[model samples]
Target: MDEIVRSNCTDRMRSYLESGCSLHYQNISNLRHLHSCERELEDYINEANAVLKKLQRLVEDAYDATLTANLSAVKVPDYSTADSKMNHEYHFTEEKQEQPADELDRDSSLVTVMILVHNMLKLDYTMQEKIVRSLSLKSSSAEIESYRLMWDLRPYVDGSVMDLAWKSCP
Candidate 1:
């Protein structure tokens, strides 16, 4: 259970007991008052449940926003400027973007979730290599590593899909 729910339940329990405490000491009362107490308790429980759901939704929305912000902070490389013809030796010269201090503070768990989501359902390793081969790029260890990174980023591009067209190509 969520901490918010726990806290709300505790508060409601305290409030309910405080409000009904006098009933315990009162002389034999009609069943109507007992029913009223039960009804009030039910209402309090319902309200607490509603608040818990709202808090959960807010937390989920905040987590999604963080994932979006972190993913967007990564720079996709420009492939048009990259040398199409793979020479004997090649190195990516594209400069990576610098992230803001606050952006860099994103939780590692969120990053792991984003990476797993992107990698899920991706093409098999062999197919990925074939795709890389078609681009006239050699399969050196370093190049393959870079392509793997590109593959990881492929599924996460938001708007302007063409911006990632070349970067995600293999």
Candidate 2:
């Protein structure tokens, strides 16, 4: 990889030097550099895509779990605990009533299930963080190298490489 990159850099530098200040040389150099780095770019994309696939599966599992919960007759309870000042809110007054014990149990169970799922998925969440962090490093390095190459060839062009990059994306 180093050999190929050095050779490509040398050849491109030679071409730009020989052509002097020419837009045609700059365009060709840009395109050639892109072609040379195509393999590396693809590899980075493949790695990121692998991570994305894992994330997608996790998201799908969460979606499926939610769907299953929704379909069940068992109702999950809201688990918001009463504050100190709101303790009297649970007290039965002449105009108020209390809920059945079973209903309260169901609500508590829902909170328990949610907590369990969160705990179980902690590893996946950590893995996701690691993947994204590594992917960002890889992406940043590629972008920096591309920018360096573009800057090296800047003198030969009338416009910025960003214009070309912008056009390619949208």
Candidate 3:
């Protein structure tokens, strides 16, 4: 790569000097210089791309090795604590207690309507829905709604408030 780059640079410099010394047509000389610069630029770009590809591969390999080492060193969690059992039970109960079909349908309909309204308002409905779903997965709808409302109103309140609200969310 270095050899190719040096050769191209030398060729470009020689062309430039030759063009600069030409007397018949100054415009042609300038055009020759421009073409030389363009060729040099293309050569440099190709060399840079090759170097970037090698760097990218090295980074990916390093990342994979680091991840493997870290994962191998990690200790599995002990689930003997009362807190862990209670947390498991809570999630199990929540899953076991199913809502009525009508209620489920109603909730789904409401979400669809909200998404439609949000899209009409030119807000990013997909992102909003993703946020809502992610939050709801980890907490109750009331908790998610409270945070969502706070996030929605943050920009209007103050810049600091908005920043704080964003930091507070997952």
Q: Pick the candidate with the highest lDDT.
A: 3
Decreasing TM-score order of the candidates: 1, 3, 2
Give the alpha carbon lDDT tens digit for every residue of 4-41 in model 1: 65677776566656776445335346455755655664
Instruction: Give a tens-digit lDDT track for model 2, residues 1-170.
Output: 65765677776676765777366967889878866666565566567557656755665575566556545534533555435435565555313423434444554444444434443334444443344334432467776666555435533333433343334332
Write model 3 residue lDDT over 53-78, tens digit each, in one string. Answer: 56456545645655454454344446
Highest TM-score, which number?
A: 1
- How high is each candidate's TM-score? 0.34, 0.27, 0.32
What TM-score would you give candidate 3 relative to the actual structure?
A: 0.32
Candidate 2: 10-residue stretch with minimal lDDT: 93-102
Which regions in candidate 1 have their CA more than 4 angstroms from the true location? Answer: 1-30, 81-101, 104-170
User: What lDDT score is found at residue 95 in candidate 2?
Assistant: 33
Candidate 2 residue 167 Cα shift, in angstroms, is 36
Relative to the true structure, candidate 1 reaches a TM of 0.34
**What value of lDDT does candidate 3 attain over all alpha carbons?**
0.51
Clashes of each: 0, 1, 0
Candidate 3 lowest-lDDT run of ten: 117-126
